[model samples]
Target: MSALPGLDDCVHCGLCLPVCPTYAIDRRESQNPRGRIAALRAIEEGRSAPTPGLLRGLDDCLVCRACESACPSGISMEGLMMEHRSRTSDARSDGRTVAERWFLRAVVSSPGVLDRFLGVARLGRSLLPAALLPDTPGPSRLRPARAASPPAATSRLSTETKGRAVLLRGCIADRVQDRETRLAARLLSHFGFEVSISAPGCCGALQRHSGLVDLARELSLERARDLLSGEPDAIVVDSAGCGSALHEPLSDAPELHAVAERGTDTPSLLATIGLPPPPHPIPGPVVFAPPCHQSHGTRSTEATRSLLEHITEGEVVLLPGEEQCCGAAGTYFLRRPAKSRQLGERAKERWERGGRVKTLATGNPGCLLRWESLLRREPGVEVAHPVTLAARAYGLESEER
Candidate 1:
């Protein structure tokens, strides 16, 4: 046997039953942790090699970390899944034209370069004919819900607040919704945090998941040291994927303890600060579509919904199972647009079953972009970050303060 780490962690107590999105979607044992563990065990025993079928079971997983959250034995499904991805078959496209390879490499390595590229992409989007835009380019740069000014600097923090935090302004999130990052900063400061953007670039989660394990570790160690050098208490990350990746331990660099101690998701941090929920309840009826990563991986759904409920008077409507993935699956939407769209459409229909949906709240930018693309044809549907809705309801500025 290959002796996979944590292989014996699964007690098979079925504690993760409710949190498995694939299992929820299909109601099959094969799609849940139990089956996944079996598959891994088989591979370890050389009973079944890492064939396409085995890869599909692993790949189809949203890696939301929900299973681990529900595991009573403290089983680390997320870690296992990441290890599997890191060792899996190379799934990249065969004919990566020079431009494609260069673009991916450049963006993964350098945040400044990616931001510049996004700026050009946005300019092209503005200038090109609507029909000419690729069906699904990378990610969107447009801010959702079209709101007000976001926070500007540390000066916005009151003199009473003395602690400093490093805000890991994500490459993808910054490109799509810089406003969201600003709002996050403002909220952090409002809770007595002095926030600063210290790191120079992307977290490389996307590249790492796309079979660039070495590159991911390199980027992780580099960024870890850069942010750690500032000696901040914590690193506030608005992007779920990036934050999750940041929280992960880097085996390659044992000395980088800063990244391990300080990294936390925006919602979790907000909840940690004991920020009271909004005084006013949301007025309209809405569906809270927790991102797969946030709900499953980070398990921040309660904090997210609790925070939203405090801000608006709207009635929060959760789906039947509540743990099912919305299907965006990060870049999976781009790689498997057809399957992604199918999943998104289904989620939308569920959200709008009896009547109209005033809003759909999600934690990840990718989910927001996916919802926008899926419902672009359907008028009156609005997808926004939970914090954006909270900010609007509380009369907080959308732009930098």
Candidate 2:
């Protein structure tokens, strides 16, 4: 039995338990960070193969990385999880479904195919079963065709300009959250920076989390080649999950390492450029739900919070348990419906208890879709990306151009 790298870093500390969403909800040993590591260690020691129970324990994890943020030993929980998943054959079967695999391979990799499939889904939604369709608003409501155009570049600087940035329009994000991408581009333009939307492709984050490391590597290299072709000051990501994935160092692809080093999230990018005063005051209270990837993965909680508070009309109220996963840890809700619902409902209840808010802003697309699905019954509440709200406040036009 060979020892796994980073497996011994855990000192059996229980500090990660309280912050782990699965452990907090299920109170099971295998659901927490330490337990999972211990289970991996057992496998490393040749005590157990990748049994169904072991795979289930690993699959149930959200991989939110909150445990890493809370760990005193600085264990890279995210890397450990990804490494274990990649090494275990049964892990892939446990993490993703057939439909998910097909979508990731066929649709996510090709923008034209995804757009056509979304068009068909939109048209046939009424005839299809409720479970088959997206619980949040339809594609038409989320992304208008005209909204896909890049925002008019504001900077006089050429493509070689110092402040020029590229926006990663990820596969699903490109199709579902097109408005957020557009808004982010416009917001960056408003700050006097040239923004270019990257080519349509998966950031490979989903594939990596699903244990398809080879596929993830291919996608990552493809993205790196495309994005690096146009040397920009920064590569900005609107989705927190994609941003976190992009930040990961790819040893096999040294060019990808450079790209990751230059990657930045939308909130952090906006904050770094200095948020301009809102052109008009927002009418009602604004609540922020920091996505787990942003809060824990990128450690940008303060940056996102400060940006929202600075631009919102009044005090920006952070949703209680902002550190906890929203259960939408990149399709975790789809795979484990019950546990996902439990966590999402818990978050919804927290927001409900905080009174009514006109708008609820979050950093990741998964978080946005999950919150929208949970709060669909509630009227007069809007779920949006923080950059969308900032774009609105700046009076930047988001209509189809």
Candidate 3:
């Protein structure tokens, strides 16, 4: 075996140490980025073998790829982790991996099933055991359809509604997201574009992240065909993780390259088309938590940050752990609730120390839901996505029928 390509990219500068969520939580060398890289190198060189401890370390990883952002050498921790899991897929220690695989295929692979499953999960959340289900999603966790006081001034976007846009509502996204989905469509249409927002199958992100490479690849193709069928000028994704997955072109399907070529996060598109300053109605002291995939995958949260700051009149506060994962690395929260909660708490504590904020916003479904669960008890805080805020800035929310 090639022993996982790109293990040699680490210079051991230790920058990934502070940004790593698992490393920060467990304080384990074997769980850090460089440590994992070193372990793989040793295994390849025959100096070490896959022991129980080694496997356990890898299992604890969130694979959020914050290390990639912190790395000076541009080492892709996301790619490395996926490849490592694929190589060891057969040797998985427990049947839990099997259940995860089945869930991805049987339930999540289809848009319809995923919706029903999430619905049931939310309703029966209290009934489910802690180990199987993580935090209970508070009613306010998902962005409620509340519009801020109507914008004082009409927001400006391109007045010409000409281009076509296709919004890929990733499997779990449409069900849980409100502002990003309903508001995203309205925002795009308000921007003078013909927006297509509808049901969508998996993007293979969860599958690929879970080490089902072949399945992920297949799903990617299906998503490509569906996304491009509309001949969209822009394929927009409100979910950070789904958008990040399509950032890389699918080499196997040459036609699917357009999926990556045109696929963009909503903020990126809005920023590119020239987002004029919208009314700043959001109360001061708002915090923005950059989604792990949004920041790490794009390698910059500037577009989202810049747009957010402009909307809030530079009142946006960068969360202390803004660059760190929110502990919802896909399905990690569901399976490893304890670890996920602890990591979320670390970020929460750091956030609270800086003083309370009136609103908190993040761009991914997992991160949004996680925040809702974490901050449920804390009153007077609104958690939302930029699209929702954008809608308020543009006065679309008041126009809602």
Candidate 4:
């Protein structure tokens, strides 16, 4: 419906060819970035509409932005797709079932509502038979919340130089993997910054990705304004996907422009600060499946790898492949379970081929959840976030006796 960034910037560059997972999957021009842009242009000019074929090319994209990074002319493939999503008909919105829409709206917009929902779900899970829970291939929607009290802080920051950092206590991580956030706070405080978990809610990355543009922008600006009052030195988001989304424009919020100017990912922040990781080794062999966002989307795997190498005993293996995606694209597993499973199996097979890796480390929460499900169902596999492993290795958490 609108003219995208002019196509002249693409230059028919073949540099992005080998890096595109869709192209690698089918070796079709239509599956690649250049062709997708062409199709978008044609659709805009009324040469064509959303055909199954044209939509396939656009939908196949993981929005990893690897092509943007690879481009000689600086094409913004991710930006283009986000725009396309806004202009496209609601009918084409992927997997936007009524239940999914309501679920996301309640959970993301209001943290209190989400917490209460979790309480109900947890109680239901306890009363219901295990068979009643959907045997989905992704992260189990039901994980028990911390019933007991949280641990007390062992130390405090100095009075003269008290600093604050707001953690994005994400919806998924807060409910399912809260321990990761706890570990993160410990690590940050160890490095001399007082950390506080941001009020529970979503950052609207999911809405943005799913073409809920107004929701995404609205929620983002609200979160930014709230966090700004805390006057944090930095907003440290541990989830790579959330962190990446925070880097983009915040719709039309003039107030948030200054605050968002300082957003930073955990790994990127660590790299900038040059924190010294302990000279210790993890107990077992570990392989990393860097989030497609960290690997291809943001290219921040170097920071992750460096941190891993610092505190591992056995060899740390980086699996060889396209590093395209794990297919747990946020709620992608729920929406496209079959395709997500295909990609997950492909990743698992590749990991096994590298000779029996005991643990798999990744940065994104979705990847952590999906991989956990894969490992739980499959015998003899362990998957966790890299930060969890790092926190343990650094002697931060007391190991269970």
Model 4 worst lDDT window (10 residues): 133-142
In the predicted model 4, the residue pairs found to clash are: 281-312, 281-313, 282-313
Q: Sorted by lDDT, highest first, which candidate order results?
A: 2, 3, 4, 1
Q: List the candidate 1 regions with Cα displacement exceeding 4 Å.
A: 8-19, 23-32, 89-106, 116-159, 252-256, 266-282, 398-401
Q: lDDT, candidate 1, residue 170? A: 57
TM-score of each: 0.80, 0.90, 0.90, 0.85
**What would you estimate as the lDDT of candidate 2?**
0.76
Clash-forming residue pairs, model 3: 161-192
- lDDT of each structure? 0.66, 0.76, 0.76, 0.69
lDDT of 2 by residue, 281-354 (tens): 56557888888888776677787778788777777898877778888888677778789889987888788787
Tens-digit per-residue lDDT, 1-401, candidate 3 = 44576787788999999989898877879979989888878777788898888877877789898898889998888788788888888887576787887898898888667766766665666466544544756433322223322212333356776588888766777557744676777777777777776445788888878888888888888888888887899988888888888887545577568887787766777787787767546556678888988888854478888778767754888888777787888988766768888888887887787576768888888888888767766988888887788778777776553
TM-score, structure 2 vs. true: 0.90
Instruction: Give one digit per residue, the lDDT tens place, for model 1 in 1-401.
Output: 34667777777888887767567666766678878888888887888987767766766666666777678877777667766766653543434323334555776477667756666777777788656653444335542222223246533324566477777655677657666677777667766777776544667676655545677777778778777776788777767777667767556466345686777756667677565655444566777777766665545578887777667675777754446566766566655555555667666676667365667777677777766665666777777787777656644654442
How many collisions between residues are there in candidate 2? 0
| Worst 10-residue lDDT window, candidate 2 | 153-162
Off by over 4 Å in 3: 126-134, 139-159, 399-401
Query: Model 4, stretches more than 4 Å misplaced?
Result: 6-8, 91-102, 116-141, 144-151, 155-162, 252-255, 272-280, 296-298, 377-380, 399-401
Q: What's every prediction's RMSD, in angstroms?
A: 4.6, 3.0, 4.4, 3.7
